[model samples]
Target: MELKSHSPFIKWTVRLLKKALYIITPILVVSILVTVSYLKQTSEVISKSQNEAIWFVLQLTKEYSEFIYQLQSYQLGTSDYNDMLIQYEILWSRFNTIVNNSLVEHLHQFEGSITEIDHHFTYIKAMEEQLLQLPRTKNESSLLLLFKNDYDDLQIYLNHKFRLSSDDLGNKINAVSTLEIIFRYLLISTILTGMIIAYLLLRESRYHHRLAMFDSLTGIRNRLWLNKKLDKLAKNNQAFNFYLIDLDGFKKINDTQGHHTGDIFLRHVASRLRQLEQPHCFSARMGGDEFAVIELIQLNTSGATPSLLPGKLVSLLNSSTMISGKSLTISASIGISQFPTFAKSIPEVLKQADFAMYEVKQQGKNGAAYFKPYSVSTMKNNPLSSVS
Candidate 1:
């Protein structure tokens, strides 16, 4: 069977689900964006640092060759000796940056490579000293050539070692990439699970809310909801009539026919009350074998009596009910209490109505009466049987 779309709980659940989704969606999106941004930044930093270290090693051989060319130019009187001195200072600064300033230089393998570079620099410095002393040596060109060749071989060896280290960095980046993918999937899954939980909690909250307002057995408004309506009307200063009803001989019915039949009878009473399609009329099953109602009274200029709704209600209760194909007649004792006419407070009105209904019971069942402030003696003696 197709379900009706008029369920308040389902409507509320959908509203709550949408609200939760709205709250969490942006947070999850931002979190993933931040994570991806951080990963990209880390990758860029690692790549930049590794490339810088490799470039420094590669530049060393070129710097040495430049120094030799500058020296030859000085011998030929085409370059000043000051130019060669500046080149030497620049080369030494580059070497210091590779040895001490680079982040990758702290590794054990890098330390050995640095030591070898230092040894090579020491031999180069010794050759520069010898060339300075013998300014016009006949074999200067051949000696410079041999020095350049040895330094070129050292540069090639350092490049190979740096390539191996760079390969390791590549492997680490690959691992980080894998972890990033896995983390992204897990975050998405967690977000989905959280949404599911929110939906379930919304459903639970709606169920509890319904339980709080409606009667569990007869599906009418319960005592708590009825009390709330009474308080609201009293606070608003609206004139209304309150009715308190008690099922007469309900105990006898339960004893003879069992509690299950008693339950069915109560449901039947609730159904009859629900059929009253009057404006500003509300009915509630206060508890077992007892009910209450509130009907707003619109007074005319001629001042006709307040609606005789309570009398009609009592008549309905006195009608026969068909239970399991057997005609069973039930009667109710009803009491009337009017707002502002009797008292203003909701509790006082309820108390007066209850007393009037008890008076009906005193005069026998199947009747209704208006509340009157009877003395304690009169209450004991049924001297005032003002039933209508």
Candidate 2:
């Protein structure tokens, strides 16, 4: 059977899959970087944690060699064995604690040797308890008493225990080497992943540079982006106005119909605005429910300040009904200012337009207000208040 025809849906699916792969590749790289870092960190933690145990082992063996002479002296000359016994008990307790903590803290694949060390510590502890109790049976008068035999047996038993522990650790050295190897491989994998992601992100950024203004969410050019585009026809110092479009009662849509529906509504609103304006009319999302537009063709006249263009906005965004199965209508209060007319500077012009916008909000919800000079009160009466 020959499958000769190509399916459009299949081709589309393949394209989407490739796009997804491009996106996921960067994430994988980043994840590998983090993983490798954690592996290195874990290895360092294990290495540092073993130090206390190793040092204890060294001290314990040295004391064992000196222990017989100290015990014999204490028994013969009325010297107390209490200090020597106390030191030994404390060292043994500390050794057990360190081994137990390592077993619990390092449970990953790298901690197998640490776990085995804890297993041997059980015998070490039993040997320790037997040694501490030996002090009670000491006698000064008998040089060849029953206590001497017991003491010799105790010392021999302890030395043998220490030697056995040392051999067990010799076997675990191979384990440490193995863990170190694994960590190195993990670290290398992470670096490769990071490089691949960095490359993909660069490609994505290159594609985005063509867009004059980007949506805060989807990263697409907006009306404001269109207006502020440096490539406009302003070759001879032509002036242009900045017009900001806003959706009135956008909060109502978000509040009544829920945010997911509101997001879809906003995207639709943006798409519609994109379609109405020409390529010369660059636009962008100014903020939530707010948009901007700039002219493609340059002119000598100033196009600054509230570019509401009279009732031009009212005609543009006045139609809407039923978003997300709910009846709805959208409107906006426009504010406009003239270039080099309402205010001398861009900052002043924007300030005047913003002041006019507040006036529209105060007057009513749906109307345009142009920049007009008005006095703002710097001082209000101090009403009688007991709290102050």
lDDT tens readout by residue for model 2, 1-388: 0011223454465557558767766665666566567656655654654453445545544543344445566656645668656655655565465465545343222334444445444544555554555566544334223334544544464344344244434445555566557656656655665565565566445434433345545344744554455333333344544455667888988898888878777776666566556654555676778765544334345443323233455555666756657766787665544444445555664566566556556656455555656631111111111111
Number of the predicted model whose TM-score against the real structure is largest:
1
Candidate No. with top lDDT: 1
> What is candidate 1's lDDT per residue for 1-388, written digit by digit as tens?
0012235656686678768767776767776777777777767756664676567776886787787787677667788767866876777666666556656443323436777777777676667665555455645567667677767777776776577455556665775687598667858766785778676777767666767888878878889998888888888888888889899888988899889888889889998998884678988889989998888876557543646576677778888988888777878888778787766698889988888888778877677777756621112122233333
Per-residue lDDT, model 1, residue 69, is: 84
In candidate 2, position 250 carries an lDDT of 86
**lDDT, model 1, position 228:** 88
Q: What's the number of clashes in each of the models? A: 0, 22
lDDT of 2: 0.52
Model 1 poorest ten-residue lDDT run? 375-384
